[model samples]
Target: MKFATAAAMLAAVLGSPVAAQNFTSAAEVRPILDMTRGSWVAIREYGGKDLVYFTHLLAWRCGLREIRYGFNGAAPNTPFKMEQCHDGAAQPNAISGDGVFVSQPGGSVKEVRVKLIYDDGTTDEARFTRDQILMR
Candidate 1:
């Protein structure tokens, strides 16, 4: 199916009005390169809970053509992963993704790096800090 048509269907499913031609480029995957150049890790540890929270940070501005992201966990990490991403055009500004990190003994997450590549050939990066991740 064509991307434009798929996007329209997605918009309908999301219950939001997505402008036509929002995603100009084809849904074709781009090449992977130096992700470290424009990316930061977003992770936080909470005591001996044996769980670490990690996520991908997106800018408030919409118009993102594509997004390429990956994760790098700190030491003592375990494999208890649950990941999700939000890149809906209907809510472009709210684009984001997050997952769980399990650590042994300490239950700490040192960091989670994220890189976002927009449709306009631009990039944005962010790392989640303890203060920002803590719930009120």
Candidate 2:
């Protein structure tokens, strides 16, 4: 009886999924300085002559929702590009992935790939890790 009870307790503890803390707003992301101020920038190397510039923003509502990007210094007359962003229910911009596994709420997992486009009409896709992101 003692062994059975101990085994049951162990199983219960181990089998239970870890509760993931969700961030519901863009304001919740603190690591990124001037998040509401300056744009996030990414540079990609093109066919040797062109350097592409990519800027983006992330927001969360309920789960994770907004993801938008556009050219660097797009003219006011130009329409800004945007997209619906998903973080698998984790914080808006806090989730990390390696193209194969995404860590999210309730210990849930997702497989995804992110593509970054630059103003110079260049695109690069890679397995982004958390460290690669420069929040500000």
* TM-score per candidate: 0.31, 0.29
Candidate achieving the largest TM-score = 1
- State the lDDT at 83 in candidate 1: 31
Please, what is the whole-model Cα lDDT of each candidate in the order they appear? 0.38, 0.31
Clashing pairs in 1: 40-113, 40-114, 41-112, 41-113, 42-112, 42-128, 65-119
The parts of candidate 1 lying over 4 Å away from their true place are: 1-62, 66-108
Query: Which whole-number lDDT from 0 to 100 does residue 18 have in model 2?
Result: 24
